[model samples]
Target: MQPTEQPTKTESLKVAVVGTGYVGMGTAVMLASLGHQVVGIDIDQNKIEMLRRGELPIYEPGLEDLLRASQERLRWTGDYASAIPDADVIFICVGTPPLPSGQPNLRYVAEAAQSVARNLNGKLQVVVNKSTVPVGTGDWVSRILEDHALDYSAGRYVVVSNPEFLREGTALHDSLYPDRIVLGSSSPEGIERLRQLYQPLLEQTFTPPEGMPRPANYTLPELVTTSLSSAEMIKYAANAFLALKISFANEIAGLCECVDADIEQVTHGIGCDQRIGHRFLSAGAGWGGSCFGKDTAALINTGSEYGYTMPILRAAVEVNQRQRHLVISKLQRHLHRLQGKRVAVLGMAFKPNTDDLRDAPAHDCIARLMDLGAKVTVHDPVAMPHARREWAHLTYDEAPTAEAALRGADAVILMTEWDEYRALDWDQAVRTMRRRLIIDTRNVLQQLPQHSTVEQVGRTTLHNVPGNEVLAEALA
Candidate 1:
């Protein structure tokens, strides 16, 4: 056993995580680190091959190391038949991508369940839904399984709703030291089996990886065991609420700028109140990731399905979409028109430390700049390759380094909050660019040379101050 893998009272489970995407790969490695024998199955042969060679298809912090440390207990294969038959616990972590109507396309989820069902043996199995899915999906998976199997009566399986609450960059940390673990199933046997499977994490018995210590005052991970539907709803509710808080903070930020108040100071003041503990209270170029946007839209769609309208969540979604334009507006204030001007956009990955560009705000900002006829160049420390391959429609020059992106640029927009970007020499930026206008969407940087002009989204600066009328005009 590796130093990271400790002895557990719970028997080492034969675990299978379907889909080698961010969530599935993270969960698979995490299970291995907890002393579970894991097989990660995916339809993509290339991805499976990559995993077998100890390579990652995607970027995540501390994941490669964890995968290396735990690969002895982990297996990878493209064939579900080979992977699923012997699995004690199966985690369905496939993508539930958003449809054109904003409802999740559960085709992948259904397909994954069907594939696993055909291979289900007589051994009692726990099928866990680790994908962020709509409510009632557990029952839906059960029905699918029944439909797939002619001998459904032979295989006894329990569908457990256990939504993952992991952030992209910090997935390893979040999975091991989760704020809580939610398991929902009507079957006592299934729930008990899952409870035992997650015993190491729940009891915090596993040793932390090097340089990643348990928080000084970390408490035991709360386990919320409830009905399947409630467990599903909790995932949507949690994401929608976090999205709402970020939107709320951005909404308040607009008011703060017009009134000459700092959003940082205001949020800090409000955050002190225990009722509003500050976490997602950051006002930035809105939010983009695998979660917030899709989850919020799914929640709103769910409401509409039940003949209910969530006005607050709808408003939150609206505000978040508009928040990205604030960067363009700040740019306009500096350079009268975007046409023929060269703009440098820093940070392309949704947030940082991960190469996931799913709905990244930088995408929208750059697309809009392209529409406005601006000659745009971009740079992200890690995500540039994905941006280049996946976003060929976005025909913009990319820089190898942050300084190269800023060289001779008319204006700069800081989208993602990478530490390397935060540590950039502002004086060097001033020396490089033709015009040193910076719009700090994330409010990450602190010090800058006087020659460089900086404007943050949520605060009032002399260069980009907005009066009540300007704020109203912005709304227009």
Candidate 2:
């Protein structure tokens, strides 16, 4: 059903969220802001301690401010017993990292469920599956709870699938004003309870938090209720489709490079067709982060269990991997051999406005460059600290600033499109570099720096290789 024409009021609920990572943290804060009493439960003591001290373990826009505003209604703890017993609603938001077989390892989800089951207060409680799990996971979780919980029965508990569709950087905004909220459960009572819990969000009744105003054209979000399996499939299908769109753009960009066409212009032209939206169509270093790679792999693994093959999804993955190598190949074409060359990488986080480095394209690019005997230095506005801790085993210099990273470099690779990188003083950069070369993988530069050899994928670029002056002159 659609949201009401006027704002609807909902009674506050006692909510407990398991796992204090991205989804869990955001959900806990959102619910608390809606006047619900929320306790964020995580096994990680450090994360719990940080949350209690008004510090955030991860980087997400506007989350810290929201958490601070809702501190009175929110609590953080490492002990599940303290948080789970009195909760009217329990959300399982744990991680499902993939295994070597492409299947999601559900050990954490299983553990969390068992813990919640053992602590149940014998009162009616709605257990929600908010983690992105395989299609049949809702039933599996139900079985686990039944096998462990005391006096477990339909009257005492219900399992609901409520998968999240949050992006890493803009997670909080997406949660508060999502386009739709999908709830799946066999019990009508469970769906009604969640609908009441999300009434403020669905009806846009809650006052907007400071520094996070609602969009001008915003409308109330729809509430979609489905069977447990359909809700699980929705999350995987949505992510796989987005991954496919990015891979499609990259594949087209490769062809654009061959035929002297510009991907920026091509995407813009095609995006106007209405059938294909403009989002996720920009071609550059292919997508990276936790969700796209993990979700796509898990979706493919699900197909294999039923003896089905996903050729299109498999091709999309291959295309994404190829984009990473394309960066190395482009550098080699310009400089011939990378041995002893001073190369600087501009962004390390998989994407801008975040400190997440999982499966980032820059990782593959830096590794290949270092292996080719090139000296590599990397810089990101907020990711350097996390990179130092996670990627310390790799031998690479960490530049304190973008300018510092560019100094004396033979070539520069723009990996992530940060505002600071986009607004860089290219004139100053050209003067300090040993060789004026840039590989604009993100296509973010406004104008190409004069007298510099810049190679951009899917666009005609100048080559400054020795004895290619005639070709350079013609292109200019």
Candidate 3:
């Protein structure tokens, strides 16, 4: 696969992307690479300035490279008046952070809609809902534009729900090669315009970028057109289902531990059944990111709004929360008491390859460990900078290397499954730690050091040290 240097003039549409976060940034870069002229608009001056200087505000693999590759066709701005007027399509990629009641705070979306409305320049614009919003938000945005925008009688805009399904770490690849493209609106014209805009992706006609090659035997993305509400529901449903899968694995993993069965083997066996394919089944420190947990809660809240109780989704949420606490429980059981204990934590990011720490299991575990009077040190290959910012007030040491975090620690806990953590020298780690105790939460370590005690979630404890038999007897 080779990257394209020049824009292809095949029906290039002028596009404006509002809110240059993960979804917005990826969308803007992808559209430009697909030959559309894209302008990324954001309220954050820092982010806009950074992007304008050919730097990405957020961390995602291959995103900055792809953004640089497609720089000629892409531009970033802080003003809506300059970006939205001449665009053929506008994507609302703003944040919808969860409120205390589990409902998404649509303030950013509302603000973006209002701003886009004020900037409407009488040209027909297909406004897209690229953010994961509650059902009926598409209609709400349309109404907001109708009430606020000038010349409503002139048919200046039509709203469409085009919810993005991009994951944080692999967002750019997901955008370039999506499983499907869903567009929802009452206006057939609005749906058709988006279809045209995504035609290259839908047909897989564009040359694949250098680093991200198209998977062999990969099928073209399915384009699903539906009513506005259904399209919005699809994004929520997909995320909720994936969350359920992970939570379900963790729930069963708890049972596996009790029954002397290995969760890793169990999930592998059931995953081959064809009915339940293998994906998101790895039982670890549960799931955390911008999507799964928030989306599941939103789905449950949406159900409650209509007087329907979604028990399954509620259970998934409960399971995930409980799973994070399991780390604390394991620590307490093995170490007896956490007071005055020095613990080293590896991997602070929710998962690997990105610096996103939103709702990460590591934060909850670290907080509990702190409350229990244990000294904590943390390390991650990429998330350290963000973690330092998020956890500065909380008294915890930040280690530059995994070995530094392991030094002089009573117990080492594997929180995130970064490859760097997976490739640690266990023998040296055992020698460096004050206590020879290791907690493999993610089941990442393939082997353990000789004469060391290792505890894994959903598996039997390994007591390789001679005197550790007493500790095993205590656990028994």
Candidate 4:
């Protein structure tokens, strides 16, 4: 291959992004917006058609506008073979959802890699693993390509692990202005090609990083390069530490309940520490969403595979699971029996912004409450459709807002921390509800109205009842 001049703004390269889910679509849209000709390939025909029509399959903020703007640059298709052959880089962004046994199901990723392997036309293509996979997966992909092909050259394909650290709702912003672009490849040429591809970002040419207030994009000095394993570990380690912080806060909240100390005050005092940053320190219903739980679990499982035990991570997972029950325990104390109680759940999606319900704590809470005989009415900003489909037996409400779900409820539980739910008219909701009982599971309601009965897991009142003591008292 001849050395080509550095890509200019007008120049466009053919890029194929396999898997049109959150990560894949966000990448395709961002690359296309940056003047790269991107073809998004997915098995879902409906999703491809939606993308082709400039309609995003997922609910990502600011994505549709970008997709609309990049009309000529971005295209969608279900054909993977054709897309792979005509691409400079093919990114595998398929899902690696965890199995029931807490192991990552990499079937989708392996299948995608195999498909790329089968269509190797001896052209120099950089196969990047955009999906979050286990360590040594890059090596596995390289071997898969070498094993499957009838005729394969030594440097025909270079495997790189460019794990994505995108938050669901603000994925587009995260893509355009990422905290750090990590490129992992053993080959020097592979690294240079990726660097060239992301040169615009590194130079801050296309999008200026100075004084950018995009919530998702935190500007950095330069891209970070490392070995394939280190890059993969960076993703898992970052997520694990964040999950640990959340679980740590929850554990501290439990202790605050024991000694009549308010968890909010405790977190504030400790969060000011520079080393122990205050990013994920908010004590809540528990951490959920696509990343934390699964990644942490995968890390633990990875540790076990190597005959090492991750006790702290195991405890984090346990605490997370227990935090959901903590909400239930609070409700059981106030209402005595959940059977036949008209309970309203404020949010269904794990966190807010995106409609992703994978491993959402609300599901576990709703299922447990239903088993205990509570008639649950759930509502979310954008996840109602997904929730309804997942939990068919439960009733769903699509009112103008959260107040509709809170109306005529025995008690309301704030499951997901949506911004709308945070700024809700508590007084109006208290008055409209059949009962004034409110369990602030996410610790969102820092200040409670005088009229309404508000109970949080880690806060204390002048009445002197500690949160944990109250739980212990109830259990005793």
TM-score of each: 0.95, 0.96, 0.95, 0.91
Question: Which digits, one per residue and each the tens of the lDDT, describe model 4 over residues 384-435?
Answer: 8776677677544445567887788898888887889888877777777888
Error of 3 at 264 (Å): 0.7
Counting clashing residue pairs in each candidate, in order, gives: 0, 0, 0, 0
Candidate lDDT scores, in order, read 0.88, 0.90, 0.88, 0.81
Off by over 4 Å in 3: 1-9, 465-476
The segments of candidate 2 whose C-alpha lies over 4 angstroms from its true place after superposition are: 1-8, 463-476
- Note the residue pairs that clash in candidate 1: none
- Per-candidate alpha-carbon RMSD to the true structure: 4.6, 2.8, 3.6, 5.4
Evaluated with TM-score, which candidate comes out highest? Answer: 2
Residues 1-476, model 1: lDDT tens digits: 11234555768989999998999999999999989999999989999889999999999988998899998999998888898888899999999889999999999999999999899886788899999999989999999888885467623888999999998888888998888999998988888889889898888888888767887667888889999999999999999999999999999999988997888888989999999989999999998998999999999999999999999999999999899888899889879888999999999999999999999999999999999999999999899988888888986998989999989899989999999998988777667888878889998866555555678867765332334354333323
Candidate 3 lDDT tens digits, 1-476: 23233534469999999988878888999999999999999888999889889998878999988889999999888988899889999999999999999999999999999999998988779999999999999999999998999777435599999988887788888988888999998888888899889988887778889989887767878899999999999999999999999999999999988998888888989999999989989898899998998899898898899999999999999999898888888877789899999999998888888898988898988888889999999998998888778877677898989999999999999998888877888888779888888888998866667677787877777777555655454344
Cα displacement (angstroms), candidate 2, residue 463, comes to 6.0
Off by over 4 Å in 1: 1-8, 462-476
lDDT of 3: 0.88
* lDDT accuracy of residue 390 in candidate 4: 71
Q: For candidate 2, write residues 212-328 as lDDT tens digits.
A: 878777888878999999999999999999999999999999999898777888999999989998999989989999889999999998898999999999999999999999999
